[model samples]
Target chain A: MTEAATTRRSRITPEREAELYEAVLDLLREVGYEALTMDAVAARTRSSKATLYRQWGSKPELIAKALRHNKPTSLDEIDTGSLRGDIHAMMARSDDCQMDRDAALMRGLFHAIHGNAELHQALRQLLIEPELDHLNTLLRRAVDRGEVAADNPALDFVIHMLVGGFVARDLIEDRTVDREFLTSYIDAVILPALGI
Target chain B: MTEAATTRRSRITPEREAELYEAVLDLLREVGYEALTMDAVAARTRSSKATLYRQWGSKPELIAKALRHNKPTSLDEIDTGSLRGDIHAMMARSDDCQMDRDAALMRGLFHAIHGNAELHQALRQLLIEPELDHLNTLLRRAVDRGEVAADNPALDFVIHMLVGGFVARDLIEDRTVDREFLTSYIDAVILPALGI
Candidate 1:
């Protein structure tokens, strides 16, 4: 525990904490990770620097946790019975606007993640691994039910294809990723690769 | 043309110009696009700042051109008479170390591209479009040969899949993309999706 945590633990309510995380994400979207400052977060959230530091310890910790908080769905809980259904449900969880915001936020984080090892580790721990594990479970269920081949190589690239779909939208066509595009991509590229 | 073009367009030899571009790319890999400066390029290449600015007009133009210069293969020129062979040749154009360096350089550029509209336009015009056109030609040839159906929806995602394969390697498995990995991915994921 840093100086802040030892002084005040659990002082802020969960509702207030969520608001703080939202503020962090808002700043991230507006200015990106490199330009974002602890001072800015404190001012945006109307919280003391001491409180912010006490709660999160550092900027990477705060940013990583904020990203985690922004994820509205727990992927592990999404079970639609079929692999196709599950994948569609996962994409449908976020609407068009939310997906756009998420894409920008992710683009903002990519540079910081590349430069900062601490941020990278935090993200892998707090954000990426959990989601990967959840998706793995979803795929494992597909394999169990014989919806997909157990030894299929395309299985390894499912995440890459999905992520590339999201990241490439702006670069390829200068378009925003929406549920409709993802649905078509799922139907066309992903399913065909999996031999579904 | 800027003052550089009018003043002395052909003063720098082709070999010297290539050396300058290589220095710019080395600086990009070291300090990233955000921090790269004309002064640094001049100092590193033993050229005057005025000459550097006059030649390239701006950092974005220089960086974009450097990236184009660094591409050892004219992807358009790779005609192996088979889509698989063409792709494998594309991946094999650079050795393993070059791929890792290119990946790092690309990761560096991602943040700069997000923030700088000017850099983004230069990159799109000078770097991305040419490559896309080349890949499209390759795909078109494959269509002509009946290796892949023209109407296949996966045709639209071919670039996205290949790019995702490059970008996602570090993100997912923390691995440097090599010829073997890309070859396997092409055989397993891309080829199967194209129904080859």
Candidate 2:
């Protein structure tokens, strides 16, 4: 139909798209994924609902874009020579990244993802996949540098430890992920687990 | 109110109460926590809703009773002579005490507990508090035995590693807890983390 064609034709520049995505993150932090609506996002960003619909197609897609925008890149790249130093730097980088409000937002996102397959997939792609990729890159570097064995049995457990530690601290213990905990975790658990 | 007092006066005996609680667990596993109701529990147990109401005031309370009934008791009394043996046994016990169709029920419970504060408290008391108490007791024993120093730096991290490992495997990886993972986890991570 002509209407569908018009909706598809109205495209914004990349700069405006990034601005809208940033606005979505702000809204997500303020209102959470469950309470967020396209109307609210459009109103906040001074855009139209039609524009959002044409661009993202659905609420999950919109929230996925927002999560991707705010996704932490603290562990992207670090070459501290030794595996211990690299892990130390990686843990320290994530120190200031822990926000109490973020935990609430994460809980909201988690609730949104449960029972909704589309949202779950979108969340894994935007949020979970990126972190996994970054950790893989870091571990791959360690393997190449001969810091850890190429076929280390504990390699699989490292990622689980990092993520599990944070989630358990937040959800179970109801505490912020602290720097002291991260540092000792690296020295005591991570390095030893990986047999480095 | 007089009605409330009258309702409280019609309490059932402990044996009948246990039967009703078991029926609630069956309904929860079969139909899920969200779909579960007092009527369904009463019908399943061949009891009246009045008796159910007299025993437990709310749906959350009923579910809490079911959880308490099914909770593992050995997790609290893990004194296997050594800290390593105690932790290994504790972690491995999760594999033996299996619940039928529990994964789906747990997922449903996770969703149900998010927004409901009373349910959250009840779940913490029924599910989480027992495990925490057991772990705390084990750690206290370790401290008393001087196997681990009183000023052990990685105590919290070790606890997190053990508990977090299983939770993450279940929630994120969608895997069942097994003894092999638990043994490797204790040997590779917990032992070194405690400098054993």
Candidate 3:
């Protein structure tokens, strides 16, 4: 919201921003959101807390910046020529590459989102909304490709279930994400649920 | 594991155990798992911490006892004579009764589970195993009645999805359980996914 905050990100080179964001994520994984202080982040990155505060007005804003900057590029536009292929590609991407530090970072993010409305909104804006938008784009492309019905009632719920199931399984069961689980989920649940 | 522990539970009447467990849960909700000391529980219940320690042996054991004792009863064995009717009843009961303290208690349990392996095992034994057992019972009954297939691929996944979905929705979306959402979920996703 502050002018310095708005320009701080722009002033930094893209590579430096990525380095700082990665540092923040590493701290999140190490200490969690509650204990993640800007001063600690500044110390970790060898920057001053004043610089961080100038860049991001609050902890949530700082976290939002980190999350937004580190958004997974695994969901790149994969045109597999069919909805099933696209879905499988997406699920496989989720199971393989997307479940590493992101899942652990999200656990911390979940705690942050619980008690802070501002953090929750920032999460929605920085993390959830972009992912949802990507999924919507994929689904819309499927509709365009005629691989699925345009009136897919289960689209949103399917995406929610997939992501929700993975996170819940990791958090609750402490299990590694298996490709078999994801593919079976897609084949048995999401595909049929969508009447594909 | 201690003789004193068994003797305490057996010697105390069921009503007394219920009262004590309720008090423990109240304390858990108030102070969270890390801060929930036997001393606090004793003070809250007008008993001594020694009695709590003698009875439960450890904090994890005590918390597990509280969770087990306070678990919601499974939906009445509905002889509604149809799988859909039975599932609807079960889901409705979950939406209405199992949600209030269960949500807060689960959050506390998650925090405890993350911190202590012994507590995690105790919680799984006390909380998760029982619910999964009940679900298995319901599904087995449905299979026996010819309402659902014995080899339903999505059976296990369905249970996980329902529980995971509800917990994730409640925690993430901050929405109370809605009957319509449950019913539509059953119709749109669960039943179909199970090949019913």
Number of the top candidate by DockQ? 1
Q: Rank order by DockQ, top first?
A: 1, 3, 2
Worst 10 residues of 3 chain B by lDDT: B103-112
Question: How displaced is residue B130 in candidate 3, in Å?
Answer: 2.5
**Which sections of candidate 1 miss by over 4 Å?**
A1-18, A38-58, A68-72, A125-127, B2-5, B8-21, B35-72, B125-127
Candidates ranked by TM-score: 1, 3, 2
Could you estimate the TM-score for every candidate? 0.83, 0.69, 0.77
Give the Å error, residue A169, model 1. Answer: 1.7
Scored by CA lDDT, what does every candidate get? 0.79, 0.67, 0.69
Cα lDDT for residue A172, model 3?
A: 50
Task: Enumerate residue pairs that collide in model 2.
Answer: none
**On a 0 to 100 scale, what is the lDDT of residue B51 in model 3?**
76
Native RMSD of candidate 3 (Å): 4.5
Better of 1 and 2 by DockQ: 1
> lDDT per residue, candidate 3, A104-178, as tens digits?
666555545656677666666655666677667777888787866777667657655676566556645667567
Candidate 2 reference-contact recovery: 0.36
- Which model is ahead, 2 or 3, in terms of TM-score? 3
DockQ of 2: 0.31
lDDT of 1 by residue, A1-196 (tens): 4576545656888799889898998887777776688999999999989888877888888998786665545554888789999889877877899788877776666657766776666556655677678778889999999999999999988888887888677676767788989999888889889988
